[model samples]
Target: MTSEKRSIAVRFFGGAGNYTTVLEECCTHILTSDPTEAALVEWVKSNTKATSTDGIRDRLRFLEALELLEIEPERVRLTETGITWVSQTDPNVLFEQLDATVYGFETALEALQNGPKTDAELGDSIANTHAEVNWNDPSGPAQHRGWLQSLGYVERSDGLNSLTDSGRALARRRTSDSPNFQRQTYYTQADLEKAFDTSFGSYIKGINPRTDDHGELSYIIVKAREDGPYSDELDGERFTYIGEGVPSKGDQTLTGANKALLEQAEGASVPVYFFYQPADRSDLRYEGLVSVADVRYVSADERDRRVYEFTMERLDLEHPTEFETLAASVTAGEREETDSDANDGTNAGSEPEPALTAAEDEYTEVQRRVRSSAFAKRVKSAYDFRCAICDRSRESPAGTVDIEAAHIYPKQENGRDFIRNGLALCRLHHWAFDTGWLAVSDAYRILVADRPELEGYEEFSRLEGAQITVPPAEDEQPHATFLAAHRELHGFESV
Candidate 1:
């Protein structure tokens, strides 16, 4: 208890600088060669010139005041707020940056979905190719690239660049939010195989087959052209032998250099697609072939341009492939078991699924809910689609108006998981509400009485008397009974 008091005292006196110093020490101590309290103390002493235990405790309390350090027994760690501060200095600025990175991420992802690119290639491949990045300024693309790399959105591969899955997910979210772009870029069969340098079924789709001359034709699955068996015109009928292994694995289907060449040669941007045909050795067995193609470029810079001439009719969709059948069967079985359990209440106390599976399921559910068209547009409507805290609107380019549905009584707290228990909050308001620094009252007004720093925030000051955005229908108001119960449960006054 003495140690705890001493630590709090130090944190109380610490300023932002001291907080930074202590945080650096904690990170270097926790993440480096040594992990000991003595080592951490020595590191802090070097920065603050404090020797005695009392001096260290004083500095630590100061750091706590700055919100940079979290104290545990014999160890210190940086809080999420601290990490955000250290990374970008201002949480609001960092959030904006994250949003911008997400936008740029969408543009790059379209290219990646079409084909692979080097870092330089992706920067060039941005859809707004004509716009120049303010390289003379530090707050520019170069800086943003570093930020993206730090956040695990973009990655380096053999001097080339690629998008991580999280990056793709973010891009999809941004794309779904905006309607300017049609479909994310598509790739040809040959290009698709070349980009990944590995084969995976999930990433490949939209195959188109074509033939080369001399009756020595090749198949262009989407944009990927594959050399097929040689053929000759006989009696106006062409007899051809679709050769096996026309495309060797080592072929350079699409390269950064290749994309650059196309950009220069065309004098206009072209959508890219990775293309490939199956690796079937037998001539007759090429019937049920699959390939991956992404549509990245559209002709004439118009939304209505012919992106692809082929549709489902041109492609063979009658036969389900081996992988397709297997996946379908597994999904069917799982659904059956889920339904059976739901009805009979069987296995009521069964152990939970594996951690990885559970996490994946949760992540998938979150993504699904967030990306749904109706939910994406209306989530903000519950709060009148404006920020319950900041009231920022989509009209302001710098400010985001989109709001996410947030829990008032946390879902984990046995709060009813319904709209009445939820508030449509902008990202900033969402963070503040979730952190317990602010909350809504039973009267549907904002409250920050316990949080002095936040109490004077614009939302609380100017908007206190303003009713939060209510549902269009009167019946859609938060359940009065639930609100009463919640206020009673939390010891909050009705007003």
Candidate 2:
């Protein structure tokens, strides 16, 4: 086992003067809540950190290495190996594991056997005891003192580290068993507010993105339902998210939320965390950390105007579409109900509006945009993501489906968002149908306008009477009312 010790400079373990109490408390916190990165940072700032926000995460990773907790893309949680120690009256099981893993454990014991040593001397005695791996006080001696104190093997007085009675026995015999050591409970939320030095209540948005006062992007929430106002589409490994803006009111310009996400594509180091809100619950699930892969200004087929679309690449989250039953944290329970202003577009709440100039107008438009997205998704799914006109289906290597949902009677004409009023078409046919070049008959057959002189007519005319592929559910099929209205509006002869 000693031969398998990490060959790197990880001579010491733990982070920023971490203690056994800190590790045990954090592991226990993971037992009841999803330990999202944001929450964990907040926790460290309050409980640790006399100076800055540097080593908080390292402490969490320390807990991970201790086999007391596990970290995922979205959140951290307690491990079953941790389950035994968190509830045990004595933490020697974990301390013994630490004694086995961390170097310099016996060196400190052996040195203190002679007499008490000053903190500096004790630190020196422990440093570089192992071959080629060295560490500073915070990662090395400070952490060593902390765990030693936790195990009741050491005590400190006036800047000195000395073995206790147990420590002396352990020092003399080089072995000791600890008495029962009761630990205190951890308050994750109270700790969070205190650490970040801010008051936080429940957020009232469906999607919330957190940016600091300095305008740094922290994380985003992706809330999905089978049919919802916005289409945050998950295709293969790529996530195509509609930028926050309502398209029905006018053209979507990339400003507010759209701009922030677009900027993420530029910096690879910028970590954009993702949280998933299950439609049926108020609590959110951590999807994982993601980075922006691509952003586009699109002339959307459904909206008939340009809107920003953000494509995101998952870093470590593989099964976002599948959720495991993980515990919810303070971040989840504190969420309030309301969603007009959920962040520039990670869909939003809690942060100051960066695009305040257009706040009122934009909020009003968000509702319409969400509705339009839901309609398109419903229509597209009903047709199994295939183009009805030519019966062609295609998906990009990037996992993007090429089919689009089209409105038969037209949004400009105030057509309602009903299943019968929509059709799934490829981009070519979608444009052709919208421009009056083609129509769908009440008999569900393809109809092309009398344009023998039209380009591509030779191939298109052959499909004149071909039946349209439709949804299996009768309720989802195209309605005769909308089809007849579309035929008449486009100058198609009655069938």
Candidate 3:
């Protein structure tokens, strides 16, 4: 196929790797509750840092193209086929669907069927087949290679290209009518359990049989430190955590295991299963198959040693029980049931408990504590307990740092208690952010509002137009909408 055709196909069909995020978002929103297009867009913008509606529209269109979504004039919902696709535990089936649906994929496969060919040879073959347009450009064949590799159909070794067993099978069974078309056996959960054998040990011990390129086991054990410098918690379809870099004896550098873990995570092409163990117990509470969503390198101490911070999205499962409990606590008032009280015999005619002023106060306090604690944990972990505005932090005696989580939009305004709505700031910067003196831009540049009283203050003046310390993932950074709201609230112009 020609490059123009390929480009058009990509625009219509969506890029190979790009579909996963949007698909996950769709499944998440649909499963949570049916949401309108506007609600989906808003949720994505707030949670995923999506800047425009076009990306969302294109994804929705792609889903419709693939027959995964049933789009009506006013609403869109998943089709039965789409629901099955999302619910499947096997990744191979998802790969097969992509290979079968992507535009120009079949033609590219046909070209590679005869024999192993270099990328240039494949491009030349495709170019010769279509004389109407140029396919000789690097991007033309590179796009094909990318799709094929992402679908697990092809591999490259020593600069030579070859088809995997699945690729060979796909090539031979090109026609949809063929019995073997897009068919392959996959490992079942029972099979994995049998092979790994967790009866006498933990899930971590069970999955340790497989090893990866980093000379470590295929899976990494993440201990959820809900109360410290390195912690982890789940938020909807994603799990956020601080990367491991606890100081080793006699040296302040990162641990060797952590270094290897970071390298593998950073370079991984496949999803890695993370077995999450709670702080109080050593046994595994839950396991999530995740891909690294974000990573940031931050200074570990005064010695200038650096460590990685991670944000991971769960690709294979729903939220665990612990996450559900925490989520329940944060949104308490909305879901609390008063039916029992209303049906009680003694309280039926007794003024309906009169709002229980003290109880209401206590409930509000509990909500704030739960929401703030979770929000603070995520924000502090994201920035490695360093201030975004001033880049200062001190270790507390309890192993926690002195940084605070400051909300860009206050809770009274119906702002969500999410990572995007928070920033890790030192005590001084937190005060400045709460007041009108300091604000941040969507671009993450520190904007100091024109304050006549602080004209001679070097500490405040030096930060004007300075870039704040942001998370590695674009989506985890402070959202532009929240930043805009903060700026407007503080009467600050764009810097």
Among all candidates shown, the one with the greatest TM-score: 2
Candidate 3 lDDT over residue span 368-425, tens digit each:
4445545666677798879988788975432335577777776656565566677889
Per-residue CA lDDT of model 1 for 1-495, tens digit only, reads: 122111001221134213333444455554443334555567667756456876766655545444555665566666565566666543232323344323344455566656557656655655254244422222233333444555445566576656555555444444442112112233443444454343435443233222234542132222222332212111111111121112232222233333332221211111122223334421111222222111122221223331211111111222222223222333343354335433553366652221111122422332222222222233345557666556655532212234566656565554433344556677676776666546566566665534446554655455444555556654345545454444555555676
Rate residue 226 of model 2 by lDDT: 30
Name the regions of candidate 1 deviating beyond 4 angstroms. 1-378, 381-384, 388-391, 395-400, 414-417, 451-463, 481-491
Model 2 over residues 368-484: C-alpha lDDT tens digits?
Answer: 333344557678878877998877888543234578778888877767545567899998899989998788887898898888997878877887888999999976787676787
- For each of the candidates, give the backbone clash count: 44, 9, 0
lDDT score for candidate 3 against the true structure: 0.56
| C-alpha lDDT of all candidate models, in order | 0.40, 0.59, 0.56
Least lDDT summed over 10 consecutive residues: which range in candidate 1? Answer: 306-315
Q: Candidate 1: what lDDT? A: 0.40
- Angstrom error at residue 322, model 2: 24
Deviation from native of the Cα of residue 223 in model 3, angstroms: 8.6
CA lDDT, candidate 3, residue 15: 49
Ranking by lDDT: 2, 3, 1
- Which candidate, 2 or 3, would have the higher TM-score against the true structure? 2
List runs of model 2 lying over 4 Å from the truth.
1-364
